[model samples]
Target: MRIALGERASGGSARDQVYLALREAIISAELEPGRRLSENELAELLGVSRTPVREALVRLRDERLVAIVPQLGTFVTLISTEGVADAAFVREALECAAIRLAAQRAGEDALAELQANLAAQDRAQAAGDAEAFDGLDEALHRSLCELSGHEIAWDLSRRANGHLDRVRRLSLPEPGYLGEMVAEHRQVVAAVAAGDPDRAEEALRHHLRMVLSGLGHIRAAHPDFFEEPAD
Candidate 1:
């Protein structure tokens, strides 16, 4: 079901609103992989016109979250293991470098922000709010990139990280995973706060490795959700 964008008096552009809503739905898995997205249905459901829905779908396609097939329709892109693995590798390298740079340059305020984000994640996890926790996870990583003063790298990392997020969410249903993730974040925070670049990088790498391992289990559990590797 689509969430309503408030009253018509706001004068907000429908295309932008539709774009944001569809992006969130796809990222949160509300729109399942390979599910067909009908422009007419979406426009009707969202109280917008087909023009805005079409624009939103095109943007989603650019983001690789939706695919347009000739003579068929747009479908939510399937999560591919190879895609996840490649994205994970890129994220790990960028994030590890980010953490190390953060350790070298982050001040007390920046460190505190990171700590607070992790605390919020913990609260979200305890409340059984995986979606909220996921948002905070993105914030924390992005904050690390910002701390490095690398806006270009941060922007690139953000896109790559979106791809990795699909695999990351797959692990949330596993038993005891939340607690383990909390501990992992704590260790990374501590390392950054200690101003130990090497240690921070190590911690970041460890966290990425853990995420990759979790993705392995997800792959095993839902083979159909992923694309087969090219022969």
Candidate 2:
């Protein structure tokens, strides 16, 4: 949402550009849940016409990142516990499978790269740079799928984990949470380096499930940002 539309989005597919910008803002909590949005306002913010903004809104609505109410307005969708659980399940499966293959095919070079990523994660944790830490998390996961020689799996995994991203972002505020995540990541990388597929898979599963396991605590602390499961 903070994109300077005139400067950045003037050349590319304006609708796709708008969509990515708004999606990043939503994921990063720049556009908080239940926040009101309007095509007119977004168009003005991005310095573009309303057409592309309207297109972008439609895509976001389909992703359930935004909700449209007739005669009311558009707003960011509140995090739903059920949706987070579902995304977490799919992400776990994909990542576990991917890590297994990575352990099989990974060479010394790939293992070394993962170690380098862990070193960066350590630095991010020490600096309290959650954004950098999260970025490194993605890099580490993507590196696993990349080593599997199935780049498309990483893309699919990313798309499937969309809902979980919101939950993960919320957990970043918890005390010592990021450091705990870094430790789990280190364990996974060490297992992969050992060439032990079963160990690697278990470690990856545990690492990825942290978001789901911590969901309750986050929901308790930020009740207004989430909708409870239907009885």
Candidate 3:
């Protein structure tokens, strides 16, 4: 399959370009889990040298997105259940704290921004624009974290939640899941607007728990797409 380089090569180094392209591919699931990635092939496809491709692969390996097999080749790393579970646990804890702070700190404008994001999400769902909904979902969550004034916490949450990015997109394909997610966001907004820290934390936790549960169901249904622990 021919890979399309969406943008023209800029003045940046080839390694940077390769890194950005490969990262995008992984995040969009264009590069399937466990798929082999040949250095020569990717270098040729990206019109870059093998050196840059190798560097990019090393960076991706560090991020746990790619694994190198001795004398064999490089392949996309299958996200392990244990890794996903750990990420979800950390994200839930941090986000719960974030929402609690937002309940106390979010001003009217912040609340309005969240409401606008919800409206956009509703429109995306109604129009069956899964991609747009995903973008809006991330934006809403980031906005909430920013409003809470927990910049460090937000950074940590974003990093930990990276593994779930594609999984969330998959979950959106399930029927009524998007609508339910929107409804959950509404509950969170209501709690935040009312300045009820306890309610906001509870709502946020419930939402994340549902998310983790949905991911578990997906993992069960698509064993090929997910990692299986060695016996």
lDDT of 1 at 80: 71
lDDT of 1 by residue, 1-231 (tens): 754553321356778788877776776577878889898888887888899889988887876778999999899988876767777788888888787888899898988898889889889889988767777877787888888888666677656655567777777767888788888888988988999999999988998788777776887886766677679
TM-score for each prediction?
0.87, 0.90, 0.85
Candidate 1 runs further than 4 Å off: 3-16
TM-score of predicted structure 1: 0.87
For each candidate in the order shown, give its overall lDDT on alpha carbons. Answer: 0.79, 0.84, 0.81
Would you list the rank order by lDDT, best first? Answer: 2, 3, 1
The count of backbone overlaps in candidate 3 is 0
User: What digit string (tens of lDDT, one per residue) describes model 3 on residues 136-175?
Assistant: 8888888878877887787787666646765775688889
Compared with the true structure, model 2 gives a TM-score of: 0.90
Give per-residue lDDT, candidate 1, residue 27: 63
> Model 2: runs farther than 4 Å from truth?
1-13
Best by TM-score: 2
Give the range where candidate 1 is weakest over 10 consecutive residues by summed lDDT. Answer: 2-11
